[model samples]
Target: MKKVKKIIWLIGLIYVFCAMVNGDAVISSITTEAETTPIEDSASYLPDKEGKENKITDPNNMGDSKKEHLDSEISSGHIISQETLNKIYEQNGEKVAYLTFDDGPAPGVTPEILDILNREEIKATFFPIGENVKKYSDITKRIYEEGHDIGNHTYCHIYKEIYSSPESLINSLKKSDEILQAVLGERYHFNVMRFPGGSFGDKLAPFRKAVNEAGYSYIDWNCITGDGEVISAPTDRLIETLKKTSQGKEKLVILMHDSATKATTAEALPDIIQYLKDEGYSFKPLSQIEEGY
Candidate 1:
């Protein structure tokens, strides 16, 4: 009888223990479900315009929309604009040269010059007349797209017209700038200027003051390829002029032309580049010109 009683007690204890474990499991499941608050609706992640959740369409792009917006801002063109051209330095006492071509974007000449520059992996600044840029907008676009700097060289490239008065010069510059921005798109802003026949003489006083007041920097070349003086100057003479003028200058800004008639300038470019390289001079664009020179 005692053994029967002991067996009954043991069976009752086992049933009570099993019930307790099952109750604990049920309580745990209920607690987890209450805490989770299922994500079947996206209200937890994205908010709509009225501070409510909206149904998602194309989740991939929308999910990364912020990143895409930032990327577009990064890819926008970086236009340099300042009165004083900032200096760019080369380490270890290296010489720097800026190769600037003026009065260009002429159909055949500009393209050929671009090819030579591309072949040599060099960058140059082009001061295109407004009329020329309007005439050859496509080539002007190419110049900007190829990562070269463009400066205002006046609308007419006419000495009498541009140098007529301060107002005339300023108008010419403003018009030329408009043409370039139109061709190069809205992302670019040019504050660099180069006078038609070099920024000199008493005639330039008022124009210089106007340009300075308008937040622009005017540049004059220290060396020339002689292409400006004579149309289609001999290749040898052009090369010699470059070599002679650039001899003592550690930071040389060379003047050359890319007008349709000056094919010789294009021919002499490779030799000039090679000679500069041999003399341990680095080729740069006028945008890198140092101020107070």
Candidate 2:
């Protein structure tokens, strides 16, 4: 009886030892699998050229790369640097006058204005609305050929349509550019714009940002002839308004209109130019202002 009990005890000990060895082997296999297999990070995966998923080497550089791509795609034909733009806005003690005509290329008025500018030997900037450019392509071409800087002034010049949103304003400017290009040829490009009613107040902040992002610069007038305020204003009143608005400004971006109704502006141009010249101001086109910087 004692011999049989010893045999049973030995067999039970052998079974327990085998079970322990199998459990250790199963744990080792699981650990090896965990170390060998890779866990995917969904955020780190990007599409490869072959349309397969690939891991980004450095996720931090992705934003910068994307920004660079976007910047390269943007057309910066004649975009002025922010520093140069700031100098234009601030008075720099140098007497410079930039005569800018908006809503123009009219039959009689634009020609008269151009003739006066030619006689004075001064080059000015003209912001012709797209509608007017279509109506008077010849005049627009003439203004460009005469060595005047041409800027985009929205398509329809309707405040409600343009001021509805920043996108609306950009679209209008682009549409006007298309019209201008059609008139001026494919080689002609302009990177300057003027907001109708001016880009002022907090309301236009988004529009200003959008314009800059689109690689365009905009200027607002520091002096005005009030031709837009009172269509067909008297020549003397226009001159007086110019004098009043131009007071104490060393750098003047003088605004006037050459729309069909603004014939008086044409009449006032000679006197306005004379006054600026007498004030020791050198006339410059708006496009050339960046060259000094």
User: Highest lDDT among the candidates is held by which one?
Assistant: 2
lDDT of 2 at 161: 94
Candidate 1 minimal-lDDT segment of 10 residues: 83-92
Overall lDDT per candidate, in order of appearance: 0.81, 0.87
In the range 1-293, model 2's lDDT, one tens digit per residue, is: 99999999999999999999999999999999989977545235566889787645334456887656544544324555545665795655678999999998899999999999999999999999999999999999999888898999999999999999999999999999999988887767878899999989999999999998887788888999889987689999999999999888888899999899998899889999999889899999987887666
True-structure RMSD, every candidate: 11.8, 19.4
Clashing pairs in 1: none
Q: Which residue pairs show collisions in model 2?
A: none
